[model samples]
Target: MDGAIWASAYGCQGKAVASSAFGRPSGELQARADSPTPAGIRQRSGAEMIMGQGAVPIIVGGEVVGACGVGGGPSEDAEACAAG
Candidate 1:
């Protein structure tokens, strides 16, 4: 199944980031940025793993300067399986 791209840009307080879905990232990253739900957090799995689901946090002087992310969607039971 096709997945949606979710991203976030962080700047001290943090915010959403905008990026193309063409690039493949990590689901965990994206879920944290987009959906905070249990399902969103545990989506994607295996070779069929969904793309754009990870986060990149910017740190400066032991502080979180910013962060970026990408991912979300309704695929198969991969997320459920992964969660289990």
Candidate 2:
């Protein structure tokens, strides 16, 4: 599957944004407002999370601007896991 697609689908946007702002590669963020944990929803969060690997932030000019998470699911694990 596509890592970007999964990340987009699993609410990885926040993580990506945080990564970009913090200049860190490893980080966690809630996908939804009702989410119980910011890290993720646990086993019920879906294959994208249950089997997910890691999230990597995209930094620009010493600041996080976005992120690219890899692994943890078929869609995002095509190549390798990008840990944040």
Candidate 3:
């Protein structure tokens, strides 16, 4: 999958965000809301979520082939970068 992370002090956070993308259709914000667990989906999945944005499915031919995660600051900027 094509993705990029900018200036994250926690290296794993970037990977976590990217990987989390594949698990859901909505971004992190919605992910938390849709979580069936109380500890939250990320915690259940064994990753600490620092931010709530960026990361989306790369759909092709009506199927999700991969994902794109542009994690940096706010969800909007990251999302825009990913979309860009």
Candidate 4:
């Protein structure tokens, strides 16, 4: 995958893993929305969610330690490679 896609995939997976750990599916969005800001400033919404099917969280001792994302091939092939 290209660097941009790789980075985006990693970021998305990280956020998802974090949300799963916290048991809040919208934790990232909620936090971004709830942040205090200047009156004239408006927080942006509708952020694109780029999820790479090949990415999976690495769990250790019942906690998510890290993640791995693979791209550049068919989604299922990438996922299978990552799974193995």
Candidate 5:
């Protein structure tokens, strides 16, 4: 769940990075789109695999203390588990 841990550290949802990576296959994901390349899918999977998923930051007093990663079924299912 490295992706999930990274998510907490970055203070962003796991899906955000994945989506960005998919939406943009060339250059920085934050850059131009409408010209997605095969590299985009690779980047997305790599980031997700390396960063982790189905995880949520454990915050206390407005500070992140830890994170929880859940994986069993689909990413959505995992995310739902983490959310609860």
Candidate 6:
């Protein structure tokens, strides 16, 4: 990919440090942290995880494989792009 594209995508630019780590979509995680469900509260995960919709975790065989982050558009659009 070209530098321009890389820079535009959140994680593609060697920026989404949690690329090596694995977990739910950052938005969900962030939401839980911000205002957890009635049954339970959550602790802060880390800085690498962000509070947005562009990140999509790549899972295989029930295991986290990698991730994709598309950041040049709205939340739904970017999320769809990454999922594809």
Specify the poorest-scoring 10-residue window by lDDT in model 5. 24-33
Question: Candidates' TM-scores?
Answer: 0.24, 0.36, 0.51, 0.44, 0.40, 0.56
Candidate 6 error regions (>4 Å) = 1-7, 11-22, 33-46
Candidate 2 global CA lDDT score:
0.43
| Candidate 1 lDDT, 1-84, residue by residue in tens | 134333312211121121112222234344444454423433431122223334344446866544444224332232332223
Please give the distance, in angstroms, between residue 71's alpha carbon in candidate 5 and its true position after superposition.
0.5
Q: Candidates sorted by TM-score, descending order?
A: 6, 3, 4, 5, 2, 1
Question: How would you encode candidate 3's per-residue C-alpha lDDT over 1-84 as one tens digit per residue?
Answer: 134354543533543354344544235554454455523655665654433456555677877666556554666676666667
Query: Between the candidate structures 2 and 5, which one is better when assessed by lDDT?
Result: 5
**Each candidate structure's count of clashing pairs:** 14, 10, 0, 0, 5, 0
> What does candidate 6's lDDT look like per residue over 1-82, in tens digits?
3224544654432223333253555444444444444113222343344446666777889888777766655656666676
Give Cα-based local distance difference scores for all models.
0.31, 0.43, 0.52, 0.44, 0.44, 0.51
Better of 5 and 6 by lDDT: 6
Using lDDT as the yardstick, the better of models 3 and 5 is 3
Q: How high a TM-score does candidate 3 get?
A: 0.51
Candidate 3 regions with alpha-carbon error over 4 angstroms: 1-34, 37-45, 48-51
Over 8-71, each residue of candidate 2 has an lDDT whose tens digit, in order, gives 5454443344344334543333233235553344334442332222456665686666667544
9, model 4: CA deviation in Å? 8.3
Poorest stretch of ten by lDDT in candidate 3: 9-18
Compared with the true structure, the alpha-carbon lDDT of candidate 5 equals 0.44
* lDDT-sorted candidate list, best first: 3, 6, 4, 5, 2, 1
- Model 5, span 2-83: residue lDDT tens: 4344334342343344333343211133233323554455465664422334555556686655555555445556656666
